[model samples]
Target: MNFGREAMMTSDIECDVRSLGDSGKQRAIFAHFDSLSVGQSLVLVNNRPIEHLRDAFDAEYAGSYSWQELEPRPRSWRVRIGKTASDALPRVVGHTSSGDLDRRSAVWSLPIQRRHDLDVTIVTLAPGTSTTPRPGPAVDTLVHVLAGTGTVTTELRDLDLDPGTLLWLPRHTPRSYTAGPDGLRYLRVRPHQQSPVPDSDGPW
Candidate 1:
């Protein structure tokens, strides 16, 4: 199997394969993103047919997999896999509005005694306004367009984003987004980062 940085970025983030039984039956796990652009795509493997694990968690922005047991012994047969675009299109779960943005996110993974490893959220922007630009603590972020059109004006540059576009923002970059006349809807994926604690004697 051949994998690359670019391929992984646009394709599904993870995969699982296992043998079913002595009859040679095989099972596979597959996940698809809503859109694909410079940083992401609806992940497909060289035209290989895969079935989604139903028990997996579906969040507002991203999906997650449950822990699955693997076969103890490795299969003798050789299997080759390649990266290619998927012919299947993505199905929309629903649209989210700015008012319900924070509460609408679905938690995919929860760790005991620690913060979550990943957090996914869907944000919708109404026409004629923009969100305040703010810096995240320290985590990488991936944004994918779901519906409508918009212009993302960042400190670095202005980018026109429509359906099927993805953007990757490094940790701590100050950024904001605004929607076009029709409004905008997109998914945001980011690693969990704790906020900094303010000193008792803060500066005015």
Candidate 2:
């Protein structure tokens, strides 16, 4: 939720709808919704529950779309409004906290949300620890470093991984991660078309 603007391309369109009040926001939401394809979506960020927006969708797009609450808190109410089949209900609707992190030998990872074309996740690494993400076929991966520092070693070169650093890893690329003295935390965004290829040894 603390990500920079560039990290949230999905929320870029309505960057200023709030200033326009409920009327403006509603117009913007439906306009964006009208522009979506069968699996595309837009992210709406508001501090309050969007009851009116939900009602509008229910009234107009009831059978052709879906709604999922990504963040339900007061200050960060995020909703994913997408164009999906009427029968495709939300499989999960909630947040992923640190407690839900899956502990590996030197890292912890968990899913934030999974929708039609994207899967967001968080990964934390211990200082001095490393990750050997195996090479396999999958969707393109976009990584955003949320905290700390690290080194990403790929077959062709070495790249510094720092806070705010964003990287796009193509499918089947081989890479490894090394946490710095302060440890490392990052967010991974991958396409829903194909799943990420897990590390051959288990952790990635």
Candidate 3:
């Protein structure tokens, strides 16, 4: 796979908390965690260390998640938060945020991941990059804009995109994407259609 496509396979859902502000940050973090199925995780990329989020986890999800600090610097931090296998189900909650971190991804453009019965595809496009025509069914295919800005072109019309944008792809529909000057990135979630996914092909 090419670099762009290779990047989408990671199990981590990138949540830039800077957009959530001080008041909304924790709720946003909780929403991301709530969106995960058992055994899935979210990688929080933030402007500063978030020890408080850990404390919140202690109160809300104690013994339910495993936390790991990936990068801790004077100016920034990256935390890997994963949900453990549990009898409880994760709710599909809405998210709100402003922005966080001001850097571009170096490797991988689009990565494919499996979170339980769902296939989560992360698509990262460089500025001026456009996707090959993608076909999907309506309703089953859900799209969320994670970062940057872009345009989505369908047979009906062309739409401008920004962070937090949600879109749907209808059955037999084909769509194209183009990244803006800063590049564009989004997550596509859908029901898993095939069986016997290889261990090597599973989410990280």
For candidate 2, give the lDDT. 0.64
The residue-by-residue lDDT of candidate 3 on 1-204, one tens digit each, is: 232222322787878887667888877887888888887878887888866678667546657898877766655577778889553245533332222323333222222322346565656677877766655443366778888898988888898988999987765566788888877777767666555534221221
- Per-candidate TM-scores read 0.42, 0.45, 0.42
Model 1 residue 30 lDDT score = 28
Displacement of the residue 25 alpha carbon in candidate 3, Å: 45
Clashes (N, CA, C under 3 Å) per candidate: 3, 0, 15
Candidate 1 lDDT over 76-170, as tens digits, reads 21222222333222445444433432222222223211224655666767674576666644667788887778888777898998988999877
TM-score computed on alpha carbons, candidate 3: 0.42
> Least accurate stretch of 10 residues (summed lDDT) in model 3?
106-115
Compose the digit string of candidate 2's lDDT tens values, residues 36-145. 66777677777777666675665466567766666677876777677786333444433323422222232334332222455556677778788866673455788888
Per-model lDDT: 0.46, 0.64, 0.65
Error (Å) of candidate 3 at residue 111 is 10
Could you tell me the C-alpha RMSD of candidate 1 in Å?
A: 15.5
Q: Which stretches of candidate 3 lie over 4 Å from their true place?
A: 1-115, 137-139, 195-204
Query: Could you give the C-alpha RMSD of every candidate to the true structure, in order shown?
Result: 15.5, 15.9, 17.8
Query: In angstroms, how far off is 19's CA in candidate 3?
Result: 56
| Residue 184 Cα positional deviation in candidate 1, in Å, after optimal superposition | 0.7
